[model samples]
Target: MKRNKYLILILLTWSLFPFCWQVYTSFSVSESILNPISQIESRWTLDNYIQVLTANPPFWRYLLNSTIVGTLSTVLTILLAIPASYAIARLKSFSKNTIKILLLTASLFPYVLLFLSLLEIARKLDLGNNLVALSIPYAALSMPLAILLLSSAFQDLPLNLEEAAIIEGLDLWQRIRLILIPLISPTLASTGIIIFLFSWNEYPIALTWISKSELITLPVAIARIAGSSVYSVPYGAYAAATVLGALPLILIVLLFQRQIISGLTQGAIKG
Candidate 1:
């Protein structure tokens, strides 16, 4: 038990060390950030954050772009997954296992493998430098996991409720909207958050797809800030940007931590 406790402590410290360093660097002056051993107390300032937030390109715009893309992609993923997962969970016509396997296989392919094909398709569709274009692939990429999660959540639900709703003249949509959804709300929230994070942090795909400055997402924007000039890298500003980029996700998890944990555990264990 003591060994396990020590192991947990070590792992926790390892995971948190980088984030702690980032927070420290964000508050420290540029010189302190460059020299890690420098005493932060004498060199601390908010200039890095101020500069990052109020730069000419504007940090808020990047945040907005990320919010839009992540939100739309998550909504799209849920919209597509709900119907498909419901059919797989409740319908008798389809082979659930086979469908699940196919979805998993589709997701298993690395995005790198599909990057060129996606780029070609995006160009052919005239979707260059567009958030909707970014969202298209993001939605598709996140759909498989969303479907699997929703399917498991749906399957865990008692079929009797669905049958009762049906007998009461509730159509398919009504049954789903009124019965299944309410019962599986936690899972839906969990799935949405996961999809949002996937879109929020995606860099390679966004880098290839978004060429315009205005269309750049937070992750891409942050990367650009870190390497904005050929001569110098702004370590202090980079740290601040990294912290700001991660703040929203941290707040979200804190707000819905209970639901997220319960939903994931239930989905995994029940099905």
Candidate 2:
């Protein structure tokens, strides 16, 4: 028990070290950051945050844009995934296993490889530079995993429950609406949160799809901070931007951790 506790402590520290460093750097003077152990009279300042907060379009704008995109992406993913998963869950075992394997394989593929083709499609469809339009690709990218997770969740339900609903004169839509959804709500919430976080942090697609500064997402906005000047790297400002960018995701995990744990636990147990 003592060894396990030590291991957990070590792992937690290892995981949190980078974020803690960023927090420390965000408030430190550039000189202090460069020479951490050196005795410096002036070691801390809020100029980094000021610079990040005062930029054109402002740091908060990026957060807003990311939130919009992430919310839309999560909604779209869940909407499509729920029905698809239901259909998949109702399938015969052989076909279901085959399709699930295909989905798992597809999800394992590096998504970056598809960006060029996706970019061309975005241009053809006039989707570039539109934040709302970005949700489409985000949903598509997230679909396979969402469907797989949701299907596992759906399959975990006993067949008699839906059969009973059918006997009660509930149609397919009614059964799904009144029965499956409420039971699977935790998995749905967990899936939506995961998709939202993915959309929030996605950089390659966002970079290729959004050119206007105001429309850019958080990841791109932070990248701009790092590349704002070539001569000097604003490490402090970049750290501050990173901290700001991560705050929303951190809050989300803290707030919804129970759903995340419970959903994953249920899925694992029954999948």
Candidate 3:
């Protein structure tokens, strides 16, 4: 038990060390970055954050773009997944395992493999540089995992409850709206959060699809900030922007952590 505890502690430190260093760097004066010990002695300032916020492209605009894309993608994924999951969970038309495998295989195909084709399709469809356009691919990419999770949650629910609702004169949509959804709410939240994170952090897709400054999402904007060669790279500002970019996700997990945990672990026990 002691060994396990020590191992966990070591792993925790290893995972958090880089973030801690970034936080330190965000506040440290530029000259202090090379000398770790001098970080404590150097004057700290909010100038990094200010610079990031006031940059030509504007940090808040990138944040807004991320929010729009992530929220829309998650909503679309959930809407599409719910019926598909219910059909898979309750229907006996085909082997559930086979269907699940096919869905997983589809999702496992690397996004990079589809990149060029998707970009061409986007241009042909006049979706290039459109925020809503980004959501389509994001939703498609995340659909499989969302469907899998929702199917598991739906399967875990008692069939008798659904049958009872049917006997009470509730139609299919009514039963799903009032019965199954409430029971699987936790799983839905977990799935939505995961999809949102995927969309929010996606860079390669955004980088390829969006060329206009106004449409750029946070990840792509941050990458551009870090890669700027026109001016000396502002390490402090870059670290601060990274922290800002990550803060929303951190707060979201902290807020819904219990639901996320419960949703993921719901079927682990067989009793």
Clashes of each: 0, 0, 0
Q: Put the candidates in lDDT order, highest first.
A: 2, 3, 1
The segments of candidate 1 whose C-alpha lies over 4 angstroms from its true place after superposition are 1-8, 38-41, 91-94, 226-231, 264-271
lDDT of 2 by residue, 134-218 (tens): 9999999999999999999899899999899988999999999899998988888888888998999899999989999999999
What tens-digit string does per-residue lDDT give for candidate 1 at 1-271? Answer: 9999999999999999999999988988877777868765678899889989887579989988999999899989999999999988875536888888888888787878888998899889888898987898999999988998899789878989978988899999999998889888889988899999999999988998899988899988888874458778888888999999999889888988888787767768866
Residues forming the 10-long window of minimal summed lDDT in candidate 3:
34-43
Model 3, runs deviating above 4 Å: 37-43, 230-232, 268-271
Q: Could you give the C-alpha RMSD of every candidate to the true structure, in order shown?
A: 2.6, 1.7, 2.3
Give the Cα lDDT of each candidate.
Answer: 0.88, 0.92, 0.88
lDDT of 1 at 89: 88
TM-score of each: 0.89, 0.95, 0.91
Task: Say which candidate scores most in lDDT.
Answer: 2
Top of the candidates by TM-score: 2
